[model samples]
Target: MRNYLTLFLLLFTLQLSAQNHVFVETESFEDKGGWVIDQQSFVVMGSSYLMAHGMGRAVKDASTTIKFTKKGKYHIWVRTKDWAPFPKGPGKFQVSIDGNPLKQVFGESGSDEWKWYDAGEVDIKTETIKLSMKDLTGFNGRCDAILFTDVPKFTPPNKLEELSAFRKKLLNLPDSPVAAGHFDMVIVGGGVAGTCAAVSASRMGLRVALIQDRPVLGGNNSSEIRVHLMGDVDKNYYPKLGRIVREMDNGDPGNGNPDAKEYGDARKTSIVKAEKNISLFLNTYVYKVEKQNDIITAVVGRDIITNKETRFEGSFFADCTGDGTIGYLAGAEFRMGRESKAETGESLAADKADNFTLGTSNLWASLPRDTVTTFPETPWALQFSDEYHIDNTKADWEWETGFGNFNTITDAEKIRDHNLRAIYGNWSYLKNHKSQKYAKQELAWVAYIGGKRESRRIIGDHILNQMDIQEGKQYPDGSVTATWTIDLHFPDAKNSKYFEGQEFFAGTKHIKVAPYTIPYRCLYSKNIQNLFVAGRNISTTHVAFGSTRVMRTCGMMGEVVGFAAYLTTKYKTTPRGVYQDHLPELMSILKGETIEAQP
Candidate 1:
């Protein structure tokens, strides 16, 4: 009998080794279920998925628990989506091993790729081994595939594999008794646009608060990506962008050669030190938008450090959330990608239907070549060419990947993974593995600050189309301005899937538009009355967005929305009312404090 029992236990142990006893697989709470839906995407491969929503997880909690006899080494790993690393996650949740809080195994503050976590085990003092969630402060997160297997039976870490980098996940924010009950205005995004909005509004005698996810000021320019700010400031002569610009690179950090790569990241401290009235919420994300009777009554902000969730109530709100999360939540109208050519009649428009991942570009530099560095080559993407009629060097501050082949949802992981793989592969060639331009080179900078080109666009009163941009159409209610040439990155830019029998692809181009006016109607929500949108997500046809998607115009859009909110409240009127009667007032706020309008 004893021999038979031993054999049975041995068989059970072998089965456990074969299966990891999968438990949870979901997205970071940062997405708030929007990314999982059609509005956004979480495209990845080789994993189970669940949609996380409503302060609850999508996956069923596990009823099965593993019982351990002796205390030994163990681990817990959470699968990740690809796009998480691009925008990174937000929200402060926790991981616990045997009821003990895991310091910072995972959180929504930063981005990570698919990997297992080394969750050191605890002593088995009780009858059963218990693993559970702890420090689950704030709200948002999903665990679709929750597995409880012996930690020793996990896969070895792959070098090329991308894992999320987070120091710690504080589950809540610091306690604050809600900053009064209301304010004149609340600005989201804290980048150049948000800062300008706050400074200008505050100077206009309005109480304002600027919320930002990063600890520093200047959104993309905040020492993160090291990209430069090129807009209607020095080029068009605006005091608002000029004052902020002088504080940053009085000369030109993004100009020159070696210096060009590090300009955006260097301007972080400059904007913060320059703006005073802007009560900056560094590292705080506006996760939820509360609406009461058609107006956004409060903007719910979560602080990952102190684990605090505060309701920032205001008479008005400006969405610079970048992804347009605030506007989407507030019932704003928005669209993503291009329509079929049959619908728009443009040659550049798509012919078929599919999810598009307007991917990010992570550029690299090898300075003062002396030593050789080896890298892997990407079998998929090809070298830059002119036949495709695209600028090979234009992808400087903003390098893009993953537009042609990858799906935007479920395959987002694959999209981001493929992008990173291609980038490193190309870098290897530059290093010594493969060579497109150099003989022998050195490594200068691997841009940690990734420029994410597209995701969500907020729907507004007017959806700007390709024709309007081409004609340089003007509106009586025009408030903000856009200046990038009508740039359209087609469905196939680098991948060969679009054009058959091709290994490389040159990017597509569209007719350019000189600087043009963007109407004020493009800021407020088409569905929700008081909700406003700023940033890349505003209503623009995929063709028109190619040009207006630039952050410069997005900032100006934020400024316009902020001022509009002020006037809307002052007169107790609709955005249209503020626009029609307040034309001179609106331009007075945005017009040539320095330079010329769009010709």
Candidate 2:
């Protein structure tokens, strides 16, 4: 008979069916950093995941031998808030079970704290066996916990269950039911771009619906895996985008999770809901697109809380799925991954254009301050020259990428990890080992925002090209704008023959023209006439996307798409017509609005 604890865990998991199976540590284990006993699902060490150091590993990468029994149909789920720290620049983690190394099962050895996933299935040849984990330096690793349960026996009711009354109402909709539901606009994705898109478009006299996959509004910036919002808007050198950009950045606490009133852009769940025009749909993903000819008639969004599908038809739709989901589902033409130089004439393109694009991140962040020294100094402590790595503690973050290949998953997960790794790796370089070590400032804050760069590029009327960007091209029908500089990623930063590595040091290269106008032609579907697209997936050549893919730009583009949709509904005219003959009217509406939001 299974223990009562197991029974309780099963029942409790069924109750909170949507969440990851959580197994708290009843007994404190210091050998594993006590696991923090956090109340919040992802609350690392009961304070902030970025406290003292950015990531939490297997305490100090201690050797752990676990024996597994109870074989039939048992799948092990390892939910870790884990990161593989680098020895010098980037390191790998090694695990072995049943004589097969975990790298074989997990595909790669590196990850950015991807949690609540299958560590791999355990096939029991023998009743008992040992699973071992050791970092590249044989010292540092981040492990939250491993949960083993009978996959088949752990099933909840066959029928989907509903959580809230709102979800119950949505669940009853038929497959193609046309909802009388009227939303001013439905904005998908809640990243920096989506957040700004919802706020901006709503300010233009419309009820807004914001749908996100995660519970939090700030996809990357939420407490899930800390990443501070950084870009030209950090007031680095660009100052014009200051107000709207700074609106998100409430300031930094220089400490643990500060109050919303304190510092840091508190884009947490509650804060996002306060906007009246913005109806926050947390944990809802658009799984289906209802189409009428070329236009997206409605979006069938899945409310994860109740497992119900609700169709939301709006005046206009914005495809900010980051993966170009809405347009793709609606059969709007789209492109995936990097195009060869021959394909787009992009300078950084490879011989053959591959769809190995970047995707979402699973991240981790920490505050390794100068105050306490309890943070472990592992045998894998990175020793580096002034260039590759810096040598101090405060700013020295040992996060970088080594595992996962770009061939599979189109490098989506890898891109996410690399971007996150860069955050920590860049911090370490600034903190300790460098010519500018003396100039290093205290690592003020690590971001909850995971910076993901590339994804699906939705096909549109015109693909923005690098040469056009170089020449500062403008269109008469231009509705959106791109102020950021053009910064392209290299084909291979690591010089791999088959796989292109990441660009080590890259930035917004100043364009010949700043704040260049983006044409309305580029906003709508080339193939699907009524469909609209936005975000990093807009019609842009590979090189041009490098500049326009930033979240702020995506937000601006989303707003424009919404506006075009609004015009189409109000004047009963095609979006192209508004640009061709009625330009004065469109400009009038866009110019008159000041963003005053209410909940």
Candidate 3:
């Protein structure tokens, strides 16, 4: 009887200890090696994942050390997707435990949806073990998170809601967000417009918080995207409006320049750091908003790498995210597509209201090498023949996708993947089929970050239309002269012939227009009381957006918004109240006049 009691107690203790499991997020790895953290699909996928973007060659392995509570046999599961499901995906990789590679390969499954792939069972001999991801074919292989469980028949949740809850329970995240301090104004983007707004408001004696999701400052003009600044600055109604813009402009390096120095990422970062009143937060993505009645009180942002959430409280807020993400989260009225001529009464408006917006661009360039270089055949990529292929060494703005059929925000990942297919397939044809013609040229750079043009436009008190540009309409609150031609893009006829709905090339018609000052009424939300908007997401019809969406013009609009924020702080009023009550005070500031000495 004594031996039976002792055995029963030993069995109970072993059962309790066997319930140990460890969850590891790939983005939090100390050394990421060649894998890059991609947050573009986080809104849909629930979290950021690591992608191995090596064009076609295998990249360096990503390794990390994990400490386990109980050492024994455990089931390994990895969250990943095949990405391109045709026979099998090109993105193939393996997992290694303590330098021992697993037998089952990942990212070659039949389904394209993101799900957990069982990586078989392994015996963990020690409390601490080294785990690594080895890329077999580096065509954008990705991994979200890894799980090690000792419990039999244990599986992680697949649905987003359940997975989120499970992550919080396992990772021990706080229920309430950690406070990130209160500010006079909180700007939610780090593009040229948001940067200008932060600097301008900080100089005018207002505490500002500038939040950017990416590492760099310039949005499209950043080194990662490599788009040049367009439209004329300092040539507008208010000359002082674009002085900040001029300071950040790094002379046109063209659209798809391979040189990183030409875009000047460090230059923009230094400028924002110099301002004492501005607090800049980089690599932080805002996902939640707190509102009181009609005004936004605070926003909650999560660090992309650390997964730590921080709440930013502010008196006023700005929506400078190019996709109008902040305004959309606040339930602000917004439009996503073109307005019919019958509705807007503009000649350039579409005959029928439809879901047609400008497409996104993923640019690429090739450099001339001294010796002949070879590229592998991409059978999984979009196939092209000699009869229908873009016979070019480099791609520019013309290489675009997701025009009339696709949603720019929801279908962003698919659109980017389609562009990649087109790029690789076209280059393959040129290299293999027409090698004699282009033997010396090698693919130098291809932008994994897509340069987006149009998305949700937050409605303001005034919506600028094409007639405003054509007639040169001037308003009392007019500021920021837009000089770019009214440009709209459509699918290229030749490429559409081969790939109808998935056309990658774009064709545009540029209509000349006189420089016109955009109204300040178009920069603030009509319904959302304290929200100010700038960048490409400001209040503009699809027709007028063609002219007002340029970088320099968007920067000037930001400058005006900063000045308006100053007035809001001084008078203790909303954004709409500034235009209705204190128009003169706003104009005086735009004219470069100080308001009763700087605070």
Clash count per candidate: 42, 30, 0
Candidate 1 lDDT at 538 equals 76
**Reference-based TM-score of each model:** 0.64, 0.59, 0.96
Worst 10 residues of 3 by lDDT: 8-17
lDDT, model 1, position 73 = 41
Which candidate, 1 or 2, has the higher TM-score? 1
Judged by lDDT relative to the true structure, which candidate is superior, 2 or 3?
Answer: 3
What is the C-alpha lDDT profile of model 1 across 1-599, one tens digit per residue? 66764574565447545643333323223222231211113112222233322211122222224455444444555543222333443223445545566565444534455444444444445546544443232112333233344546554222221111010111112344355347767878776666666665665556777887666666555444455565554443233433433444434456223454355444444454455545657666665678876678888765533334567887777777666767766766666566777877656567864455366554545555565444333332333333432322223633455464543433443443344444444544444423444445444444433455666777777878777766778777755656777665644533555334322222556466776777777777776766667767777766667777765666666666666666766677766667667767666656544322210
lDDT scores for all predictions?
A: 0.52, 0.50, 0.88
Which tens-of-lDDT digit does each residue in 29-125 have in candidate 2?
2233222221112112211111112342332322334444344545565433334334232333444554566642221344444344565555555
Among all windows of 10 consecutive residues in model 1, the one with the lowest summed lDDT is 161-170
The residue-by-residue lDDT of candidate 3 on 121-240, one tens digit each, is 999999899999988886888899999988798788787756765665556579888898999999998998898888888888889999998888998899878889999975677767
For model 2, the superposed segments whose C-alpha errors exceed 4 Å read 1-54, 57-184, 219-275, 302-310, 340-342, 345-352, 355-388, 392-449, 491-512, 573-577, 580-582, 593-599
Error of 2 at 442 (Å): 11
The lDDT, on a scale of 0 to 1, for candidate 1 is 0.52
